[model samples]
Target: MKYLYGLLALYLASWLFTLPADALQQGFFFWRGQLVQLSGALLIALLAALLLMATRPRWLEQRLGGLDHLYLLHKWCGIGAAGLVVLHWLLSKSPRWLIQWGWLTPGARHAHQGASWRGLGMELGELAFYGMLLLVIISLVQALPYGRFRLIHKLGAVLGLMAGLHSLILLSDPLRNTPFGWLTQLACLLVLVAALWSLLGRIGRARRVTGQLEVVSHPAPDLVELAIRLPRAFTRDYQPGQFALLTLDAREGAHPFTILRQDPDTGLTHFAIKGLGDHTRQLVQGCRAGQRVWAEGPYGRFVLPDEGATPQLWIAGGIGITPFFAWLEALARQGQTRCHTRLIYCVERPEEVLHGERLRQLARKSGVALEIHTRQQQGLLDPRPLFTDPQAQCWFCGPQGLGECLASALPAGRLHHERFAFR
Candidate 1:
């Protein structure tokens, strides 16, 4: 559905750029064909963006579904709208005619539509257009991997404000006199306001849910699994496969970490993090209890029970076993504990299997058929035989290359995957 909506918005934007020039040229008071098309496109794009922001489809919550799909659509709609507006300016003779009337300055001779200072309005409009273009590009594809994208994404708000100002100053005449044009411009202004409000609202809500990270024990060398205890109002039973975004300070950016354990009885959420990335390295070194850490979401759809009724084959590679640990814990909570589960755990060295005893206990308790493959000693585990079993449902969480191997080896419907890529 999101893919369809993105295509529709793109199509509308293109159609708007090609609207007839004579209609707007004849009478600015009348509803020109170009104005009508542009207005429709603007409204559709705005509404679609709003819907994507607010709607979280139920089916998407439990599986690797349409969450990313909707976000991509929202992003593209913003880009397409900016591009169409640029074309709209080029097609209209307002640029040239304004220059002839001394509206532009000599410095604007090349870029401006008109020849004089009165044409300075064109300069402002062009400035806003370029600003919007820059913001759209950065948000759509340039900035990525959160840490790298943070500063630029923040600057997007400034670009948006510039765009709103330009529209208000230069396009006011056509907008005020024509009902459709006025409504479209008004809607754009409202979108800008709504976006700002939603951002602030999310930030405030995220701040309020901040908690303290308490170190239970340093089980592994240079590795500390912190049990972050959230406030009563914020602590809810999270699913075994979801993760939370954590930030030590409200001003700092968030980093996602999987919820390793969920104690329904105690209401404690655990995060097992190794010293990796700028954030985790700092976290593993010194982050302590009684210090506030903001947390947002129980995001991601990477679990077993939610994937429908099917016999399971759980594959874990190194620390990718985070979700598997939670799944095992969830099984214990349910108390229907015969582990008829299959686990193919692949690690580099023997010492890398940190939770071996617990896994053995889980296998014994729940009837899980356990298989431990050490690549350093025994080479890579063969996944072909696992998929040979017709009843098996393969789930993988690790490297994309490894997932691709499993995806190609298994039947399409039988395989479920959750890839942990930074970007």
Candidate 2:
């Protein structure tokens, strides 16, 4: 969030300073003129960035620390851009209300110098603005299903192209010829390319691979464990705690799932899934053994340190236990988890503890200190008692409330975690 906001602020300040001296005239013309370029620059820049993030580039994910952080930035960039659009519209229209209220006098209307494509650009920009706003509002409705949200969200690329064209055509002559004009033009070009990439459905094409589901079992009523034979994909080394966007059913789209275990010798991977949403519920119910499955990348950065000497604490809540399953299995494969490592799993019921016996077996083989806290028997977790050392490093995956409570009570830099949601 800070990275995205800081980038926006830096862009706005730099662009503002690049404005020519004479363009700094006082009164309505100056404000309106400045507003035009400022709004256009902001909208084009932000929307372009949002579209770029949609491509899910692996390098950007690494730079951002994890896929979780990258998705968070992507979501907030869209939201921030949408909000700025409203503010821009308000400022653009405020003069009319001011005039009606006699709070200001109307200046004489004159032909502008760089209105060459004014008629076309104005019409296109207005249409695109309203359309983008509608799509964004639809996207924000929590009641809307994921499919509906995705369908509406794709239209943003079309509107983004329109917005890019609008910005390129309507930039004032003063800005059109300056070095910053070249920068704006480059930004617009990138937006055009990103929009086309999105429209063509090339977002995750490169990393996509196909496999066959080898096994499926209901570990519990709501828990599913799947083993897949991804001979091509599994040839590459994958870190424990990494996940994939799995496409068991094309209609449901590729949903992210953490890799629960892996068979390096046989090119197989395992996933433990719990029905958390409509799409996930569909996956839980509709999955079949021996069916074709598609997956994209072993993505994420929730990996344990290879060389840290300090004792480490790992916490998992509900389905968040999936990643740690892979971690523990990896530790077992390496002979043992470090003596300093510990894992605490919190669940509401014994029925929801995914593969309790398997987890215990893995812990025994890996030498990890394991703790399970159930609501019925142990209530909620209080880490303060366990957090005796301030130098200890903690990695947590759980409900937001649990993370927040733990963070607030613990040492500032001790908790290391990211929300495992798009937002």
lDDT of each residue in 205-304, candidate 2, tens digit only: 8888889999889987777889999856553858888888888877657778888888777667889888878887877898899899988987888885
lDDT of 1 by residue, 95-201 (tens): 45656898743232233322343355456556656766676676667445556576555554544544454444444333344554455466557556644654454
Off by over 4 Å in 1: 1-125, 132-148, 164-190, 198-201, 204-208, 264-266, 306-309, 337-340, 411-414, 419-423
User: Model 2 scores what on Cα lDDT?
Assistant: 0.81
lDDT top scorer: 2
Q: Give stretches of model 2 more than 4 Å off.
A: 1-6, 20-25, 108-116, 234-237
Question: Cα lDDT for residue 337, model 1?
Answer: 56
